[model samples]
Target: MLSTSMRPLTAHLCLALAGGAFTCGARAQQDPDGTAVLDSVVVRSTKQERTLLQTAASIDLVDGQAVERQGLQSLADVAQQLPNVYFTDFTGSTPTLSLRGLGFSDDESDSLSTSVLIDGVPVYGNALGTLFDLDRIEVLRGPQSTLYGQNSMGGLVSLRTRDPGLQWGGSAQFDYGSGNRRRASAAFDMPLGERTGLRLSLGSEDADGHVDNRALGRSDTAGWSSRFARLKLLHTDGAGGEWRLGLHHARREGGNDFFVSTAQAHAHESAASDAGRSDTDYTLLTGEYQRALRGGQRLAITLGATEAHWNYWMPLSQYGGPSGFDSRTRQFSAEARLSSASAPVGGLDWMAGAYASRMDKSAPYLFEVPGYMRSETTARVRGATAAVFGELGWRLAERWRLAGALRLEQDRRRMDWASDQSGYFDSDGDGVPDTPYTSADRIDGLRVRDSEWLPRLTLEWTPAAEQFAWLTLARGYKASGFNLYAYTPSSAATPYAPEYGNHVEAGWRMRGAGNRWDLGATVFHTRLRDQQVVVIGAGGASLVSNAGRSHSEGVELNAALRPTAGLELRGCAGWVRAQYDDYVKGGEDFAGRQFPNTPRHSFGLALNWKPADGWETGVSVRRVGSSALYPDSTVTNAAYTLVDAHVSFRAGRWTLGLYGKNLGDAKYLVRALDARTVVAGAPRTLGVRASVDF
Candidate 1:
């Protein structure tokens, strides 16, 4: 356990500012940071760090204070809270997130379209499924390819950790809840020596299943426990230069969620004889150096390495389900960056980096056939990519700024497949011992030239001291092609093409007097080409393909208002329609159908109050509209609403909280389709926690 006496970096910054004795009256209330002061209320859209009234993109920022106040479970909570973002999880830890009606096309075992990062280091595979030492999560919407690589075609979720400083401090939190849940977390920071500091953060969590599997005679749900710890060391020289190193480790094991078999679907009982199980271990090491070059020029360099191992056993038994599968994956990545900030040319800022990564994955599963026929498949994909990208922001004048970014990238993807099959019926009508298939390894190659120039232009006119309005136009892009999962085919088949899209958007942002109210809105149209999708093959095999053309257009509005001191209200609403102009599904042409899982309307509201006394309370409500589940418009999920509430009290160095998630007990489906059964949503639950700092 670490102590709670670490000093905050912000503390030194505040002290320095005060020592400077720069008198800031209402001006400080406005543009406190001369370079550009971003509104504490809005954190999305622009790289200039200006208020929402001056941005050109659509972004949703979640602060560290908000994370604590809401007691969010995972990135899932944050994703669902934002407009135009939706995600599904068969289990609490493993989730698939979507933006503006994309994402449901990748394998359940590999990296997701929505890239997830913890402190600038990418978290590959299931390691991203967990949250341990997270401080703030920023969900940047739309095409972020200009700044990020690979999956940025959809968006990116960046998780920032607390920085350590020279001081002695720590915090501890403990929680107990329904279903015999128990969790504990602690963090500490200490000054090792003059100019050197170290900090450690650790957490452990375990909980029983909330859903029951009646046919299995017990809850085939999940009971997972995990521990994560990070140690960081920092050093600074007298000349405004700094260097830091960090080491992180985490391990998790639990009964993973399993699904029903095709035969058992009608019974509403899963095929898992015993609850499933999964194990994951992750490790990361990082180093960063920063220094001032010359004449108001600054430079930063960062390097890191990461490794992770993940294992999953669905059903876990032969009798559990003939289709139960197991998977193992490992990945490695490295990046080198060189960039300068705030060069002399009038409010100009720029950054550029080059990166490369590679991965190997294999999955083997049981077949429906007995002894004479057993099958195993493995797919290995290797790739490398490099990009030089930069965003240049120019302050046109005191009331205007222009920003734009472009990236030229090339990704080469190659895959090798191997499979084993025993003698079995020729279900595909291909004669030969369809059952006992000979194992074969074959390879395929594909490359994409992804050179994109995304530009963001913003025009702001501040007519009043405390109020301003701005308009913006921005473009974003997704990377072309890559294999998201490994498959063991009897032999290698045709390669799938890449999918990418672009968004043209316009929006406005405004903030009220005294920083009491904030409102931002955007209207945009997106065209996606070569959209990827998964189709079921004979005998439980799956194949990936690309749809010809599709378009999605919508509007979104986000607002945060503090009508009274110590109380804040935040809300988001969105309406979108996504349809396929030309789609071929199940050997049929469904040219004018709506894309799957795209809701027409979604909205959420949260009310938070911190009384002048010693108490804080919060309540929230969310609603989602119905949408089709396929490009053919053959299935749909009904509209639903969910409610959550929490209350907390503080005394001395201790704080206690009582919370109930899904307070309405709303029984809704998280994922479902006519062809594919539904994965049910969680039911109502209550929990309590206590934390102390010293």
Candidate 2:
């Protein structure tokens, strides 16, 4: 458990920060001028297209240009810069997100509490695709359950890919970096006919491992390779309608890089002698249709299907044993909505929609102890959900607007699993299980269902053009599920209850200096009831349980400046005080303690320079504060900082870039065991890239 003694120190730091905030609020920073102005940013992540200044929720947009300059190859990299958000590890391919310090979970030890969308289509499980030919990514930092339904209590991420333009064009790029890393990407787009166009994109990366395996005397243990391919088609019938169809596939294969004990201070070393491997494959199909109406109304429809497979083997040198699993998931989803910026009735802006989805997950695995025993098991879980949602916005009075949204959903799940083989038991009660216990049986199946109603209300006041302030109240929800990792008869067959949260937030956004300067700040609090929490039970099994209640409060600030043309500055900071109001496990009460693996403070700063003659350069740095992991199962991580820099030359779509990251190769833990095993961050890396258009 995290020490309560640190609370006083944290409270003092927050007090000092509050004082500094008041001092800075007196003067608004200069907005980025020319093409770098931030107020003009438009996002469609909410299923409602709106300008940044007009939205009340917390959202951040990361464009492709910024992504390339920062060399952000994974979801974790982009998440680190956003306020009040963090990813669990650098565990390649798969990313686990925790937003607003809502880091509680009760299902898989590593499943996400949030939801991700690609082109308006919902995607579940590991997000393992390359971010090539991507247009932008919008991150909404509050509960999105009113629109996205379950699995989004934490937040939502929306990704948009570049579409096929009217004209024909193509581009390609190659990059080489430290650790013998190599990457290549290419894209081509062209008109197929009078009203049809198609686009294709592909990318691949291969690199040597960063961690050295001391037991095997090798540094090749954690090596990895990735490939991604996508095809999209666009059509316009010229009758106020448009359609898009897309197909995408991604594959990743790599050495397992979880963790091992290391003696070096700043270096990561593994003790595994076998150097096990992990492989993942993902495929998705998407279709979207939109039609414009006469009264500023529109009809939108989306359909999608996806499949993901994960295969891995772990040879824990410390355990003197090996474990492996093969798991797969298939899902299908559909959504339809009727929306209008100017409704015929009352002329109020509104949207109404229905969403439905189904998913199936299965896993087969084996666990073995060198010369002792082995446990083999099979697990299956199937689920379906249906929801109806709507949102409305109306002008209440002069310079005042009110918005409301509601969502009602029903979720159902069925669990059918069995196992063979068991372990020792404590029949003698001599401080240990002295008697042996064996089993070759199946447990009764389980069927569960849950329902929730999530709602939101927002009141906005625009005292002047280009400036607004708003207050919002919202609720978030997540569905119930059964534990699938157990081989014993403990908590596997039982279903956990759904979790819910009530959130209140207030914020203000302003853009001045002719839109060259942008600034914003927000204060939020969330009260979570029946929080689903997980614990590692005997034999490394995960058990799902509920916590009585918890609450989190935080403050966030963001600013962008273009004091002069060709120069831009950006920064963001967040501070959170999150703790359990009431929590009990195994007769142990842990109230008033911070949740594991949730950071208390995070900050970032960046500078982008664009001089004449097509020359560009930028520098960015970030600091992440300490947090505990695995409740009492792991130790806490200390605060750490990282820095990255890049420079590039561009002329008529041709560009050459150089980048360096983690300049100090900061010593920090990416993950840790409540006890000894620890995994450190990757060391410093330098790379160069070149690309062209035709």
Candidate 3:
């Protein structure tokens, strides 16, 4: 186990900064060529393709090369290191992301605060099983319902996979890592015919876990194996238009991420250490078309269909072992967008679009607990949503701009639950039966209907090229739904209310005189109404409820510097205060406490260098502050710092590399329940890699 001493790191950074070897403050992208010439970044995830200087929102980028150099395996690894964005996983394969301290909870019905998109297809909650074969990842933070609908009340995540270039090319990589881990990946792109191209990529990894399972006498209890493949076809017209068809599939089968609580972490022993299993399978199909119309206008359309299946089992009973669950989800979505490509110079430009989606889910369970609990049940649920949105930007003057957007959305949900089990003792109290819920029950066709309006307004001032300042206000929502599980005697038929948020932000962007330094900063505050919360009720059944209100305020900083040739330093940091403002739950007030899964301070820094001799090296350091685990829960996780380093050399078309992660081998908690159950993070890992391009 690594010791908790980070003082030396701080001293080292201070020395470097004092010597002018490192630069700090705010977010920016520097020249990759070791020159002072900076390049503009075009972002396509914010419902439109706009340059970073032009977009009035906070965004983070993890490009393909960075992905390879860092060996990023999951979304959690990417988000937590960005300024105000954070990611956590209590369950091994499920990823929960929060921006500016919002996302939390594993309950599926909470209405995902953040919406995920691959290419142009929306992938609700199951975006974690696959993070391979990508061109870039775009994280847009803040309320986004004005364009993405309710699911994006908090933010949006977009992942774009590699596309075949106009010429034929490909690359392949293989590596061996700590704990007998191994991975292999390859990609190819080629011209198929006139004006057409095809690309294919495949990746797989398997590893013996970091934790030991004493009860099972296994050194690698939480092992994992994951595989993903993607194929894409692109067609280009002579008239500056394009269309793409994509198919993606991924699978993960392995041990769950649960680890013994730090309090009981000795020898990695746990109450249920010997019996656990988890797996996930996901697939998506997407088609997108874009055309430049004849009358200085453009048209865009996207179509998507996705299916995800996941299951996990934990032997809750030491005697007869009773527990297992599986869930399946399918969704179809489509969107049509139109924008004016040519507007009068220094005048008005606008865009409009409509979106539609239908989703279906079936979650079934089978459990048997010797004499305590036994159940075989299923929750069948369906939901549909539709919206029309538009945005108009007016160049009020040479240096001023005004933009506003609105979305009218409607959503409907239906649920049917059936169950069969053992052990029930309904103690009648106040007309509600107490549990040891026994009996076979079936409930059908419970429904919920909701409608909401999402709106956003912004004003931006550009005093000089590559410099801008903006202020924004937005309102977003998360639709309501019938409970998937019933903790009460008969309230499974009732539904929960919707969750809403209003946000305000102000920020500035600037590029230093020589383009050698660039920075962006933002201060934001959000008011949350009807926050969804999951708690335990009668018979230890899970229940979903609402908190009256909460508030979040934070400042985000991103900065970069290219002091000399082949060297670049970039860092992101944020300080947040999140708490329930008004809380009355069951007539009990729990206000004045911070939210669970939220930290006060988060920061990350990285250095990239390619000195000479075909050699390249990089170092990254990140820290996440400690915080409570749940609302009103006493459990907590200690803050931890992670360090990753890599060294590689290129010869002709081949590259050889070495890498290591979590050098400190810190024993941090990614998840905790009560004070006795917690999940441990990955330990130190090292690897050697080889790659070649053709």
The local lDDT score (0 to 100) that residue 60 gets in candidate 1 is 57
Pick out the ten consecutive residues of candidate 3 with the lowest summed lDDT.
6-15
Predicted candidate 1 versus true structure: per-residue lDDT over 1-694, tens digit per residue: 0000000000000000000001111011223211112345433222322443444456655555445444555656556566777665544565556777666554432334577666566765346555655555666666665444343766777666666768888889888877677888888989888888888989887877564566466653566787889998788888878887888888877775434332333233464557766677778877776677675455555566677665665544533234434455554555544545443336676656555666555544444345445555555555555666666667666655556666665655565555555545666876645444555444545333445555545555555554555454445444444333324432135445656576777666665766676666778787888776655444433455678898778888866666776566667788877777787766777576665666778777777676645677777777877765432134455677777778889899998888877777765555432334444455676889899996
Question: Candidate 1 has what TM-score?
Answer: 0.84
If scored against the real structure, what TM-score would every candidate get?
0.84, 0.91, 0.91
Q: Across residues 1-694, which tens digit of lDDT does each residue of candidate 2 receive?
A: 1011100001001111111111112221223343455535566523365677777777766765556555667666666567776655434555655677664342252224567777777765354535667777777777785554334777877777778877798899888888777889889998998888999999898887587777788877787798999999999988868899999888888887545553542566676776776788888898989888776777888899988887777656535565667889888999888877643323477888889989888866677654455677777888898999888888767678788888888988887778787566667767664667677857656778888888989887888888889899999777887766666655666667787889999999887765567788999998988777765554445567777899888988987776777776777788888878988776667798887767788777777777766787777777878877543334667787777778889888889988887776877665554345655666787899898999
Distance from true location, Cα of 215 in model 3, Å: 1.7
Higher-ranked by TM-score: 1 or 3:
3
- Local accuracy of candidate 3 as per-residue lDDT tens digits, 1-694: 0000100000000001101112332222335454434345566422356676777877666665555655556776566456666666644566767776666653436267778888868875544654777777777878886544334777888888877776889999887888677789999988988889999999898877666655667655567788989999999988878989999998888775354557545334455546466788889998988887876677888899999887776544332564556888898999888877534448787888889999998877666646555667778889899989888888788888788888888998888888777664446655443466557777878778888878889998889997989999999777886555442336565566888889999988888876666888989998999876655444445556777899888888877777877777777678888888897665457688776767888777878777886787778787878877542256666778777788889999999988887788866666554455556666787888899999
Q: Scored by CA lDDT, what does every candidate get? A: 0.57, 0.69, 0.69
Where's the lowest-lDDT run of ten residues in candidate 1? 7-16
Candidate 3 matches the true fold with a TM-score of 0.91
Ten contiguous residues minimizing lDDT sum, candidate 2: 6-15
Off by over 4 Å in 2: 1-35, 39-41, 45-47, 103-112, 149-151, 262-265, 316-318, 343-347, 424-436, 538-540, 631-634
